[model samples]
Target chain A: MVRRDEFVLNVELSAEPGEVIVLLGPNGAGKSTLLEVLAGVLRPDTGRISVAGVLLDDTARRLHVDKARRRVGFVVQDYLLFPHMNVVENVAFGLRARGMRREHAQSHAIAWLERMGLEGFERRKPRELSGGQAQRVALARSLIVDPRLLLLDEPLAALDAGSRPKVRAELRRHLESYPGCTIVVTHDPIEAMLLATRVVVLESGEIVQDGTPSELARHPRTEYVARLVGLNLLRGTASGTVVEVGPHAVVAVAREVSGAVYVAFPPHAVTISTDRPVGSARNVWPGRVTDVEAHGDLVRLTIDGTVPMLADVTPVAVADLGLGPGSDVWASVKASEVTVYPA
Target chain B: MTHRRPHDWRVPPVILVPALVGLGLLLLPMAGLLWRAPWARFPDLLISESVVTALRLSVMTATAATALSLLGGVPLAWILARSRLPGLTVVRGLVTVPLVLPPVIGGVALLMAFGRRGVVGSWLDQLFGVSIPFTTVAVVLAQTFVAMPFLVVAVEGALRTADHRYDDIAATLGASPWLIFRRVTLPAVAPGILAGAVLCWARALGEFGATITFAGSFPGTTRTLPLEAYVAIGAGDIDTAVVLSVLMIGISVTILIALRGRWMRAT
Candidate 1:
C-alpha cells in the first residue's frame, strides 16, 4: 500500500489458518500502520484487502467496509480498555456491539473470563487489574467475538519484565488454540521467536525477510536482523570454500557457495585468544578490542579486524586474557560454526 | 482531639487581610439584605400570588431552556470536538460569542432572528401565524439564547479532552458510530454535560435583560426571578426584591452543593 509522499509499503504475505505471523520491525517501520490497514481502522491509498475470502477494502472499486463490520479483532499495544467499563463489561463489549442480548452477552463474557482464569475479576475496573490480568482481559475481550482475523500489536510489550514470561506463555497457548488467521506485531526478537510460526521482517516500510523462526535465525539478510538473532554477519565474495573478506585475509567456510554470500556465526562461537590459535579453528584474525560489554554471564568483546566481529568470552576468560579496550587479541572461529548462504 | 485556638499563628497578615476584606466585600451585601428583610412578613411575601407566579415561571422556563440548550449544544459540541470541518475555529469562536456578549445585546440579536417580522420569525409568522415574542415560548427562547454558550463550551472542552481512542476501539468492536457515542462518548463526558446544564439553568434562572428585552416582563408568563427583582426594586418594594435575590441565590447554591458530590466522585 502507498501513503502518498510519506512511504510506500509493498508487503504481500498471507497467513494460513492457525498460523501466527509476527510482523517484526523497528519503530516507524509501518508495522502498526499495516495492522491498522487490515483492521479497517485505516483506508489504504490503493489496495484490496480480503480476509478469509471476504473483501474488507478495495480502493480501486471504491468499496470500503466499515470498521465495525470487518469481523477483525484488534488488540492494540496498550490494550486500550474502556476506562469506564469493568472487566466483564469490557469483555462483553464486542458481543453487545454485534447486537447480542445484554444478558446473553454478560453470560458469554463470564464464560470467556472463566476460560481466561479471571473468574473473580468480573466486577473489577480496568485500572484495578494488574498488568498481567489486564493483558488477559484484553485478550479475552478480543477473542470473545471469535473474529476471522485477529490482529495483536505487541501483545506483551506493555507488560512489566516480572510478568512478561508468564503472560507470553499464556498468550501463546491462547493463540495456538485460536482457529483463525493471527497477525502479531512486535520488535522484540525473543517474542517473535516464541510466538511466531512465521516471521516477517519489515525495514523502512519494506519486507526484507519472510521465513520461519529457525530460517530467520539461520540466515538473516540485514544487520538489524543479524543483531536481533545475536549473530555476527559478514558479507564477502565467495569462490568455492574460501571467502575473501579483506586484503590478505580469507576465511574458510564448510559449505561451498560461489559469488556473493553471507557468513553468520554466533558471538559465543568466536573464542578469543591472546595469541594465534594452534587448533582446528579455520578462521582466525588478530584484532584490537574496540569495546567490551557484559552479555548475560559472558563478556562480549567488539573486535576491529579484517571484518568487525563480536566475540563472547566468559568473565573468567576475560580476566585470564586481560581483555579490555585497545587490547590486541586473536579472534578465532570454527569453520563448522559459520553458516554460509547466498545473499 | 486537642483544644483548638481561635486563630492560627501561621496566618500571614498579607493574605489574611485581603482574604478577610474579600469575604467582607462578598458578605456585606448579603448581611444588609438579611438586616433589612421583613422577617415578620417573610412568609406572607413568599406566598403572595405574584411572587409565586414569577418563581414558578422562572423554574419552568429555566428548566425548559436548559433542556433545549442540552439537546442543541451537545451536537454542536460534538461537531466542534470531533469533526475537522472547514472554518471550525470560526464556528467555535462564534459558539462562545454569547458567553462574552452582553445579555441585552443577545436578547436583541434573538429578537432580530426570532421576533415577529424578523428574519425567520417573519417567515414563521406569515406561514404559520405563530409569533414567538411576548409568549412563554419567547421566554424559553430568550433564556436559551443567552445561556446555551455555557453548556456548549463546557461540553466542548470535555469532548476535546476525552480519549477518542475509546471510540476507535469501540468501532473495531463492531459498534456503530451512534452507539459508540451513546455508550462511550456520553458517559465519558457526562460530568461536563452535567456541569454545563447546571450553569445554563442558573444563568436562565437569573436572566433579566435578555428575557425582558426579547420576551417582555408579563406576569405569569415571562417575569422570572431576576425580572421580578427588577420590578420590585423599581416599585420601591426593596423587601420583595431582596427576598427574590436571596431565593435565587439559595436555589442555585443548593443545586450546586447537591451535585458537587456526584461530579467529584466521577472524576
Candidate 2:
C-alpha cells in the first residue's frame, strides 16, 4: 500500500497489510519525524511518500498532499486527547472532519470504543481517564477514521510499569485488528520485540540494525544491542589468542585477536570460587566484591581484580558464600563461554 | 529553579498602606455619593423616561459594540499571535493605540475617517448617501474604536500563553487550519475572549468623551447612559446622576459575574 521512487529510507520497509513494524531508538532517532513525513504533516526533504498507491509528498516536484486529505492517523507520545471534548467526541472528531454526519459519526465512534473495550466510558472526559484507558481512547479515536496508515508514537510510554504489560497487549491486539499498514515507534527493545513483526533499530538518525527478534538476539552488531541481550561487557587489549585485562589477568580467545578486543560472557557462565579449583577452564580471577544486585532468582556479584567479572548466583549459593561488598572471592569462566571481538 | 523567593512578605508598610489606601480613595467617592443620595427622590429619578431610554441604549449599544469587536478583533489577534507577518510589532502596537491614546483624539480620528466631510467619509457619503456621525451607528463605532483593543490584546496574550499542542493534535487528526482554529483554538481561548469581551462591553458602556465628541449629545439618538449621567450632573441633577452611575456599575458587575463562572469552569 506504500511505495516511493527512491524512498531512500536507508532500511527497506515492505510490510503487507496488517503487518506491524516497530522503529526502536534512543531519543532523537528520527522515528517520529519519519512518521510525520509519511503522514504528510512534514514534507520529506529529499524523497517521496505514498500510501495505498496515492502520492502524498514528492520533494522533487514540490508536490504535497495536505494532512487533512491524507488518510493517515497519528497517536502522539502523550496521547494528545482534546481536553475540551469528551472521549466520544474526540473519537468522532475525525469522522466529523471527514464529512460524516454527527449521528453517524458518533455511532461509528461508539463502535470504535466497543472495539477497544471502552464502550461504557464514552461520555467521560480525557483528563478523567486512567493512563491505559486514555491510551485506548486515543487509539480508538485514530482508528475510527478508517485510515489507510496508522502511526503510533511510544504507545506504552506514558503507562506506569504495572499498567504497561496489559496496555501493550491491548495495543498489540488493536494493531493486529486494524486492516492497514501500521508502524509503532518505541525506544524499549522488549516492547518492540513483542509488538512488531520486524524491529528496526535506529541510532543517531541512522538505521543501525533491522531484523526479527531472534535474528537480533543471535547476532547483535552494536555494543548497546549486545548489552541489551545480556552479555558481560569488558574492555581490554589482545595479542593473538592471549588477551590481557588490567595487569594480571590474561585469557585465551579463539579469534585471532590483535590490538584492542572486547570480551563478553553471559553472567550465567561465570562461576564463583572461594579457592583455586582444579579445572581446565582457562579463565579464573581472584577478586574482592564491589556490589551485589538481585535480578529475579539470581544475584549478580560485581568483583574487582585484574579483570572484573560478574558472577550470577542463586540465594542458597549467596548464603553459603557470604558474598557482599568487600568480600573476597574467586571467579572463573570457561574459554568457550567468552566471546571476543576487535573493538 | 530558585526555590526561595527572597522578595516575599518583606515589603515596606509605606508602600503597601497607600497602595491599599489609593483603592479606598477611589471607592470613597462612590460610597459618599450613595450615602448622601436623595432616597425620597430615587423613585422619581429611576422612573424618568429619559433615564430609561439612555440605560436601554447603553446596554444595547455596548453589546453591539462588543459584537463588532469580536467580529473583527479576533482574527487580527490570531494573526498577531500565530503568524510571521512583517511589521507585526508595529501592527500590534497600532491595535493597542486606543488603550493609550486620549479618547478625544480617538473620537476626532474616527470622525475624520467616517464623518460626512472627512477623508473616506466623502466617498462613503457619495456611494451610500448615508451619514454615520451623530447617529446610533456613530455611537457604536466610537465605543468600538476605544474598546475593541482590550479584547484583541487579552485574546492575543491568551493565545500566546496557551497550550499549543492541541492545534498540533488537531492537525494530525485531519483538521485543516481553519477547522483547528474553530475547534481547538477557539475553545482553548474562549475564557480569555469572554473576559476580554466583558471588559470591552463594560468599557463601551462607560465611554464618555469619545461618544459625545463623535456621535454628538442628541436626545434619544446618541444619548447613552454615561452621556446621560454626565448631562444630568451638568444640569445639577445629582440624584439622577448617581442612579445612572449605579445602573452602569450594576450592569458591569452582572456581566462580570456571569462571565466569571464560564472562565472558572473552563480552567
Candidate 3:
C-alpha cells in the first residue's frame, strides 16, 4: 500500500528470478507507483517487500532498506542520463558510486557497452546519440551494477515508430539472457505481448488480470483488457451451448459448462448486413449503426440492438452496404467463432 | 522579388528610446571615468605601497567572503529548493533580507548579533577573550553578510529548474545521498554556482558602507580598496580616488565579460 495525498494504491506482486513480467495498464493506473515501491524509492504504508529472500520493506517490523542498498535498477521512461557526463562515465556511474576505482569502473563499463553494441561510442554524450542508442546506454548503465531486479518504465516509448521494432527485438534478446527478474511497464499491448513472459494487467490501482500473453489475448476479463486485445467481450450465464449475454442469447460451440461465463470474439468475427442475415450463422439480431470508425483497412461499426456489439467490415463492403450512423443493420455471428471461458 | 531579412525587424520608438537611454545611463559613467583618469600618474599610482596594500586586501577579503558564502549558501539553497519543512517561506524571506536591506543597517544588525556586547559576541568575548569588530575578520563577515544572498538565490534557482528525477535515478543506481549530491547534483549545478560566486565576489569587493560601520577603516587591516578610495576623496586627493575608481571599474568589467554568456542565455 502506498499513499500519495488522497490517492491510495494497494498492490501485491511477485516475480521469479528468470521471468520477464510486463505490467500493462493505461495512464493513472498506478503501474509506475508499483515499480517505485518495488525499487525501494517509495516506502509503503503497510506492506512487506522481499526480493531474493531478503526483506527490503516490512512495515510491521519497521524495517526498510535504503534504495542504494536494495540492488534494484530502475530506468525511467525518458532515460535520465547524467547530461554532464560522457557515455562511458554515465555507464560507470553506478560502479563508481559503489566505491570502485575510476579506472576499473571505466573498463567494466566499456565491456558492457561493447556487449550492447555501443563500441567506439564511449566518449559521445547522450545528446549526440539517437534515441535507440541512448536507450541501450541506459540499459547498460543499469545492468552493470548486477542488480537483483531490473525495472524499466516504458523502455521503448521514447523510440520512433521506424526504430521501435528493431529496438524492441534487441531489448528482448538482452532481457532473455539476464539472470535477474525483470519488470517492464508499458501501456502498449503489442509491446507487452512481445516482451513479457507473463503479463499483469493493472486498472485503477488493481490487478484485473494476470496470465500469459496468449491467455490474455484469448480471454480478457474486463472491458479495458478486452478493448486492449481488440476483442468483444460480454458476461453471461451459460446453460450448455446457449449463453444469455446481456439482453440476447449467444450460442457458442464449446465444452458444455453451466455457470457464469464470458463470451469473447474478435470484431472481424461479427458480420453486419443491411438486410437480416439468414444463412448458416447460428445467431442473428437486428441492430442500428450507432458509430462508425476506420480501423486500418477495415471499418468498425458499433451496432446497438438486442446485443450491442462491434462489427468490423472492409471499406468496400461498407460502401456497398452504405453503412452510416443510425442505419438499420443485422449482425450475425457463427457459433464456432465465439469462445467461452469461466468468468 | 526582394525579401526582408528575418533579423531586420523594425523597433518601435516607444521601446527603442528608453532602451538607448538605459544603455547611455550605464555606459556614460564608464566613459567619464576613462576620460577623467590621471594618465600621467597612472603607473605611479598603480604601484604605490598604500594602493597595493588596499588592492591586495580587497581581493583577499572578497575571495574569502565568496568562499564562506559557498560553504554555507549551497546547503541552504538545497534546503530552500528541495525541503518541504514548515515556515520555509519565512526562512527564505529572512535569507534574502540582506539583498534589499541598506548595508549600514546590515552592519548594525551584525553588530547586535556578533559585537563585543552583542548576543553571541558577548559570550565569545567572555569565554575566549576575542573581539570581532574593527578587524579584518569583521570586514570579511560584513562582506559575507551582504553578498551571500546572491549566491543563495542563484543556486536555488538552478536547483529548482534542474530535473530532480536524475537524483532518483542515481539513488537506484546504488548511490548514497551524499554521493549523489557530490557526484551528480554538484556537477549539474556547477555553472550556476560559478556565476553566483562571481556575483558574490564582485559585490563583496565593492562593499564599503557595512565595512566602515562595523569594521572601521583601519589601514592594512579593514581598509579595503573601496575604503581607501573614500579616504582619498575625503583628503582631497582626487587623482588617487580616480585611479582607485578606474581600477575597480576594470575589475567589474572583467566580471561582466566572464558572465556574458550566462546573461545572454538568460535574456
Candidate 4:
C-alpha cells in the first residue's frame, strides 16, 4: 500500500484466530499503513489480503472489498468516539446500521458497555469520559459488531504515562478474550511485549524480523530493533565462533557461523574499567569515552574504539573509574552473553 | 459574562466616530419610518383589499421559491462540496454567478433563456403549450433565480466544514451512502440549511426588480408586497407605501429574530 506517498507498506504476514500479532516499528515505518490496508481503509497497490480464508483484496483478480462491507474492527489511537453520541449510542451504532431495532441494539450496547467496565457511563458523551474510559468505549463500539478481524492502531498511545500500564493490561485482557484475528500497531517495546503473542518488526516499509517477543529480544536483525530492545548490535564477517567486528575487535559467541553475521549483547552485559581486564571473557576493546549519560541507577558510556559500543556502568563504578568524555577505558563482555546470527 | 474591562480612555477617534455613524445610518431610517407611519389608520390600511392580497401573494410566492431552492440547491451544494468531479472549480464558480449578477440582469438572462419566443422557452411552448411569463409561476422562478446562491453557498460551506471522519466511521459501521446522508450528514448541517432557508425566504419576499421585470405586476396574480409598494409610490400614495414597507420590515425582522435564536447562533 502506498500511503499518500508517505511510505510504502510491503507486508506479507497474517495472524491466526486467538493470536495477537503486534506490528512494532518507529514512526513512519508503515505500521499504521499496514493496519489500514488490513482494515480495508487503504487499498494495496499490488498484493492479496485474505482474512480467515476469505479474499478481502486481490489486485491480480481485480477483486476488492470496500471498508464498509469488510468485517473488520478498527480502534484508532484517538478513539474517535462520536462526540455527539452518548456512550450507549456510540456502541450501538454498528448494530443500528445493521438494521437492528433501537431497543434491542441499545440493550446489546449496554451489555457491551458493562463488559468494558463502563457500566455508569452509558449516558455520558465522549467528551465527558476520561481518556481510558473513551478508549474502552471505542473498543466496545468496534467489538459490538462481532467483527471477524480486529485492528488496533496504538490503542494505548493516547493514555497518560500514569494510566498507560493499567489500560495496557486491560487491553491485553480484551484481546485475549476476543476470538478473532488481531493486529496491533505500536512503537513501544514494552507495550508490544505485554500485548503480543508474536511481534513483527517493521522498518522502512519492510518486515525486518518476525518472532516471539523473547525471541526478538534475544536476536534482533536490524539496528532499529536492537535499539528498541536496548542491545548493542554490530555487523561483521564471522568464521567459526568468532566475528570480526573491526580490524582488531572480534567477538566470540557460543554458535559457530560464517560469512555475514549480526552480533548482539545488551549494554548491561558490558563492564567498563580504567585498564584492560584480566579475565576469561572472549570480548574486550580499549576505547576513549565519547559521551556519558545517566540511565536511572546506572551511567551509560558511549566509547569510540576498534568497535563503537555502549556500556552501562553503575554510578559508583563510574565515579571510581572517573569515566567522562575523552577518558580511556576497556569494555569487556563474556562470550556467552554475545549472540551471533546470520544476516 | 458582563464584567467589563477597564476603559483605556485611548479610544481612536477615527474608529469611534465612524462606528457611531454606521449605527446611526442603519437605525435612523427605521426611526424615520416609524415616525411617519399612520398609526391610527394602521389597522385600516393593513386590512385593505390590495394590501391583504399583496401580502398573501408575497408569502405564497416566496415560500414556493424557498422550497424550490431547497430541492435543487441542496443537492447542488452537496455535489460541489463532496464530489470529485473534474473541473469542479469551474462548476463552483458558475454556481455563485447568480449572487454577483444584478437582479435585473438576471431577470433579462432568464427571459432570454425561458422567454416564449426564445431558446428552451420556444420548445416548452411548442411541446407543452406552456407560456411561463407574466404568471405567478414566473414570480417564483424570478425570485429563485436571484436567491438560490444564498442557500447553495451556505450549505456548501457547512458541508465543507463538517467533520467528514464521522461519515467514514458511519460507513464502516455498515451505513450505506444514502443512510449516511440522511441520518448523519443532514443532521450535522441542519443549522446551515435552516439559515440558508431563512436568507432565501427574506430575499424572495423583498424581490422587486427581477419579479417585476420577468413576471410583471398583475394585481392578484403576480404583484407581491415590494411591487405593490413601488406601485403605491408611483401613484403618489405615500401612506400606503409606508404601510407596506413597515409591514415587510416587521415580518422579516420577526422571522429573522426567531431563526437567529436557533440556527444562526449555532455558528
Q: Who wins the TM-score comparison?
A: 3
lDDT, candidate 1, B1-267, per-residue tens: 898898877988999999999999999988888787788988899988889999999999999999999999999999999998999999999988888888899889889998896899999999999999989999999889889999999999999999887888788888999999999999999989999999899988888888898999899988888888999999999989988877876897798897887777876
Off by over 4 Å in 4: A278-280, A326-328, B1-9, B263-267
The better candidate by TM-score, 1 or 4, is 1
For model 3, the TM-score of its B chain against the native B chain is 0.94
Against the true structure, what is model 2's DockQ?
0.58
Q: Rank the candidates by TM-score, best first.
A: 3, 1, 4, 2
lDDT of 2 by residue, A190-256 (tens): 8988998877787665687878887666556566766677766676799888888676778777667
Window of ten residues with lowest summed lDDT in model 4 chain A:
A1-10
Best by DockQ: 3
Which residue pairs in candidate 2 collide?
none
> For residues A1-343, could you state the per-residue lDDT of candidate 1 as single tens digits?
8584778776676778899999998898889989988988778888799989999888889999998999898988889898889999999999998899999999999999999999999999999998889988988888898888999999888989989999999999999999998999999999999999999999988999999999999999889899999999988889989888778777899988899988889999998889888999988888999999999999999999876889899999999989899999998899999889998
lDDT top scorer: 3
Ranking by lDDT: 3, 1, 4, 2
Kindly list the per-residue Cα lDDT of model 2 for residues B1-267, writing each as its tens digit.
Answer: 658876687778999998889999988987877787787887788889999899788888999999999999999899999888999999998999899999988899989999999888888999999889999999999999999999999899989998776777677678888889999999989888988988999999999888998999988889999899989999998889888887776776788788877768866
TM-score of chain A of each: 0.94, 0.76, 0.97, 0.96
Contacts from the true interface found in each model, as a fraction, amount to 0.79, 0.62, 0.91, 0.43
